[model samples]
Target: MELRVENLTVARGGVPVLEGLEFTLSPGQVLILRGPNGSGKTTLLRTLAGLQPPLTGSVSADPEQITYGAHADGLKATLSVEENLRFWASVHGLADIAPAVDGFNLRGLLERPSANLSAGQKRRLGLARLLVTGRPIWLLDEPTVSLDVASVTLFADAVRAHVAGGGSALIATHIDLGLKADTLDVGPYKADAHRPRTDGMRDAYADFDEAFS
Candidate 1:
């Protein structure tokens, strides 16, 4: 499957962050999004993942086929490492947790509660969840944050394996993850700050639409 974006305009709080953007992601390919801070990398990823609506244009991909990993590790602090994986596996209708465990080197911390793990361990767990989802497309935002040199290699291996298995990824990060991928710089697409401020009005209207729909 391929994901195509056509004349896409994405906004953050009603301010256009990327306008007239276009790209296509084919199976087994990776696209790296590069930009300075506040250049809308995260917003673009969120929009592609369908967490938010695009202000204009279209993102042509099945939402169910996409797995998004945000900057924050979405874990239950009280749950054991294995339990957390199990929960997500069940949610995704997956039967095997072995792959995820082995992929992230979590075999040693299976019984440890998420609250007690170090930042790198937690990040590994978060990335492992993507494997269990069985989704073909990965939308990762700064996935290498807080990872040590060795851990970064581990993550890079996982990404390589995923692509080898016919999966694709769209990653937003400042550092190189050692993957062969195309780069997209979002700097030129940033919206002008001098434009009118309609974010509040747009948000209020969105709330009204959600309430009535």
Candidate 2:
């Protein structure tokens, strides 16, 4: 499956940030997103992942084909690493966790509870969940946050293997992962400050004032 974005508009905190964005991510490919802090990279990914709505435009993809991993680790603190992986695997009707565990070199930490793991370890676990999802499109935001150089390489290799197997990814990160991929800089898409921005809920009820305000 492929991801197609057409004239998309996304907002943060009720303010439009990115407007008229467009792109297509086909299988066996990667697109790296580059921008300064608060550049709407995260907002764009969130819109693509269906976490929130886009103020305008569309994202076309096969249903259930996108798996997103953001800043939060999304781990169950009391669950052992192995248990966490298994839980996500089961949710996706998958029974195998070996590839993910080995891919992230997480076997040694499998028996430890997530709360007991270090920051980098937690991030690795969170990312490993993507492998078990069996979804071809990966939407990642600063995925290497707490990882060391070695771990970052491990992640880069995992992405390579994923795309080699007909998967796709949209990654937003500052550090180069040395992957052969295309880059997208969002500077040109910033929404003009004076443009009307809303969550699409406001209406002519405006002058209706305090009644629905």
In model 1, the runs with Cα more than 4 Å from the true position are 197-205, 208-213
lDDT of 2 at 177: 97
How well does each candidate superpose onto the true structure, as a TM-score? 0.93, 0.92
Quote model 2's TM-score. 0.92
Please write out the lDDT profile of model 2 over residues 38-133, one tens digit for every residue: 899999998899877777899999659999999999999999999999999999999999999999999899899999999999999999999999
Each model's lDDT comes to 0.89, 0.91
How many pairs in model 2 have backbone atoms within 3 A of each other, for residues 3 or more apart or on separate chains, i.e. clashes?
A: 0
Candidate 2: residue 135 lDDT (0-100): 96
Colliding residue pairs in candidate 2: none
Per-residue CA lDDT of model 1 for 1-213, tens digit only, reads 778999887777777788889889999999999999888899899889987778778999999999999999999999999999999999999989998999889999999999999999999999999989999999999999988998889889989999999999999988888899999888877777566647664974497469757
* Cα lDDT for residue 15, candidate 1: 74
**Which of the numbered candidates is closest to the native, going by highest lDDT?**
2
